[model samples]
Target: MDEAAGSPAVSRRIAPQRASLRPWLLLMPLLVFLAAFFLVPLAQVAMMSVTEPEFGFGHYASIATDGFYLRVLADTFATALLVATCCLVLGFPLAYAMAAASPNMAAAMMIVVTMSFWTSFLVRTYAWMVLLGRSGPIAALLDWIGLPHGELLFTRFSSTIAMTHILLPYMVVSLYAVLRKIEPSLLRSAASLGASPTSVLRHVVLPLAAPGVVNGLTLVFVLCLGFYVTPILLGSPREQMVAGVIGQQIEEFLNFGEASALAVVLLASTLIVLGLYHRRFGLDKLWG
Candidate 1:
C-alpha cells in the first residue's frame, strides 16, 4: 500500500495539478493589487452615487432629465468625436510617411512624434497658452499676413487643436505599426496591374490599414471623453465637458453624489464605445 501511494501515477497526477496552478499563482499579485486599488475604489464610488445626499438614484435621474447635464453629455461626445477625427486626419499622413521612409529616417520621425510624451501635461498646456496668446507666434503670423486672428487663446478651436496635438502620437503609432507590416510586393502588384495611386490606396492600403484606424480612433475617443485639464484651461467656460462638470461638482458644491454619478456615466460611455468596437471587430486586433 505504501509503494502504491508513492507510485509514478500519483506523481504524474500531482505534477499536472501543480503545473495547471502555476499561471494563477503568478497572476495572484496583480489580481490582488487590482482588487485592492481599483475594484475597491470603483465599488465605493458606485455606492456613493446612490447613497450620498440620500439613499436614492436622484443624481442619475437629474442627469437623465436636466438640460445642463444632457447638454454637457452631448458636448463631451461631440468633442471626443471631433478630436478622434482630427487625430486620424493629421496622423495618417505622418504615419504613412514614417512607414514609407528609410529605417533611420523613420526612427527620427518617430522620435519627433513621440517627443510630446516627454513633456508634462501642465507644461504642455502652459506652452500652448503662451503660443495661443495675443502676442504668440501664430498671432504674429496672422499679423504679418494682415489677417485677423481673434481670440485664439480661450476657445473651442484652441482646445481642439491642443487635444489633437496631444493625442496625435497615439494615432500615428497605431497606424505605423500596421502600415509597417504591409508587404511592398502587394502595392507593387497593384501598380503593375495598372491601378492608379489613388485606386491602389483605396483598394489595398486602406483596407489593410483599417484595423489600425479603428484602434486609434477608439483609443483617442475614449481618452478624450475623460480629459479634464486641456479643456478646462483652454475651452470656453460655458461649453463645459462632463469631466469638467464632475470636477466642479466635487470641488465647489461638495456634491459627491453628483460627481460619482457623472464619473459612472463617463465610464459607462467609454465601455459602450469599446463594446461596440468589439462587437464589430474582435478586440484582439486592437494592437494593430
Candidate 2:
C-alpha cells in the first residue's frame, strides 16, 4: 500500500506514453479528411502532369525552355517579393503605433485591422477597380492636378497596390502579436537610459520583432505567389502572373497537362519558400 501510494506521485511526474497518442487520435479525423479530399486530388493532378501526355515530362520541359512561361514565372516571384516588402513597410509603422498606443486606442486600431482583414476578397478587389478607374477618384484627382490621367488601372501598379493592401493586415497582425509581448518597461528603461527612440527601435524593438517580421514576410509572399484575381482583373495582358498563365492554358488553350505542370511548379515554389522559412526560423515558432 505504501509503494502504491508513491506510484501515483511517480506516475504524475512521468508523462504517460498515451499523451502523444491522444494528440494523434485527435488529429486522425483531420488527417483522414485531408487525405481524402485534398491529398488524393493533388496526387491525381501531379500524376496527370506526367501521365496525361503519354508518360513523358514534355510539359515540364516546355515550362523550363519556353520564354513566355519563364517570364510569367519570374514575374510572379518578383511581384510576390515586391508585395511582401510593401506589406512590411506599411504594416510595421501601423503595428508599432498599435503597440505604443493606449489600451482603448490599441483596441480600436486592432478592430480596424480585423475589419480590413475580414473584408470580402472580391469586394476589396472591386473597390480598387473603382478607385483606379478612369472615372474614379484617383483619376479625377490626377486630372484636377493637371497630371496624366486614365493610366492608373490595368497596370502593374494597380495590381501590386491591391495585393499589398490585401496582405498588409497579415503583417500588421504578426508584428502586433510580437510587439505586444515586449514589456513596455523595456522601452521605458531604454528611454530612461537616454536611448533615443530611433536607437531603441533599431537596437531593441527590431531584434525582438525579427521573428514576427520573418513570419509576416513568409505569409505575404506565399499568399501572393498564388494570387490570381487582382492580377487578372487589374493587370495588363503583358503582366500575366504564373496563376494567370495557368488559367490561360486551361481556358484558352485547353491544355491540362501544361496547366498541371504549371500548378506543380507553383506548388514547388511555395514549398521552397516555406522550407527556407522553416530553416531560418523553426516551423514551430510560427504556430507557437
Candidate 3:
C-alpha cells in the first residue's frame, strides 16, 4: 500500500495535468477573440470564394484562365518588387548614415525618418496628388529648366514615387536596427587588416545587414501587394493592380466571390513568400 501511494502513476493522478492547463487557460480569452474575429472572417472569405454564386470553384477557375486576371497579378507583383527595390536602394544609405552618426544625430535622424507615421497615409497620398499635379513644383522646376513637363499625376511613375516615399521608413528602420548593432571596433579592425573601405562594406557590412535587408524587402513587398488607395489615386488607369481589381469586382460589379478568390490568391502568394524566407533564414532572425 505504501509503495503504491508513492508510485509514478499515483503522482500523475494527483497532478491530473491541471498545472499544465493553467497557461492555456490564461490564453483562452485571446484565442477565443482571434477565432471570433480573424478566423471566422477568413473562413467566410474562403467559403465565399467557392460558394457565393453557387457551390463551385468557378471564380478561381476563371482567375486561372483569364488574361486580365493574370496581367493584374503580374503587374501587382512587379510593382511590389519595384517598390521594395527602390526602398532598399534609397534607404540603405540613409540607414548607414544614421548608424555611423553620433547618438544625438542618430536620434534626430530617426525622429525625422519616423515622422511619416504620425500623419495619415491618406493625407500623404493627397499631398502627393498636389505635388505631382500639372502646376506642381516638379513641373515648375522643369519649366524653369526649359524641359517639357509631361503628365506626372495619374502615371506609374507617380504611384511608384508615392509608394517608395510611404514605405521608405520601414526599410530604413530595419536596416538601422541591424546596422546600429555592428561594432565600430570591428570596422576599424577590418581596416587595420588592410581591407579597403569598399571591401569592408562589401564583405563585413552587407553580410551582417542581410537579415535586415530581407526583413525590409519582405515587409515592403507584402504591404504593397494589398495597397489600394494610393495605387488607385496615383497609378495609371490602364495598369490595374490585383488589389485594385479586387476592389473593382466587389464595388462596381458586386461580385464577392471573384473578389474573395483574388484576396485568397494574394494571401496565398504572401504566405508562400514568407514560407520560402522562413525555410531559408528562419522568421525569428528577421528582426535580429
What is the lDDT of every predicted structure here?
A: 0.93, 0.91, 0.93
lDDT-based ranking, best first? 1, 3, 2
The TM-score that candidate 2 achieves is 0.90
Candidate 2 lDDT tens digits, 35-59: 9999999998898899886798999
TM-scores, in order shown? Answer: 0.94, 0.90, 0.93
Model 3: colliding residue pairs: none
Model 1 per-residue lDDT tens digits across residues 66-185: 999999999999999999999999999999989999999999999999999898988998889999998999899999999976899888888889999999999999999999999989
- If both were scored by TM-score, which would come out higher, candidate 1 or candidate 2? 1
Global fold similarity of model 3 (TM-score): 0.93
C-alpha root-mean-square deviation, each candidate: 2.0, 3.5, 2.1
Off by over 4 Å in 2: 1-25
- Candidate 2: clashing pairs of residues: none
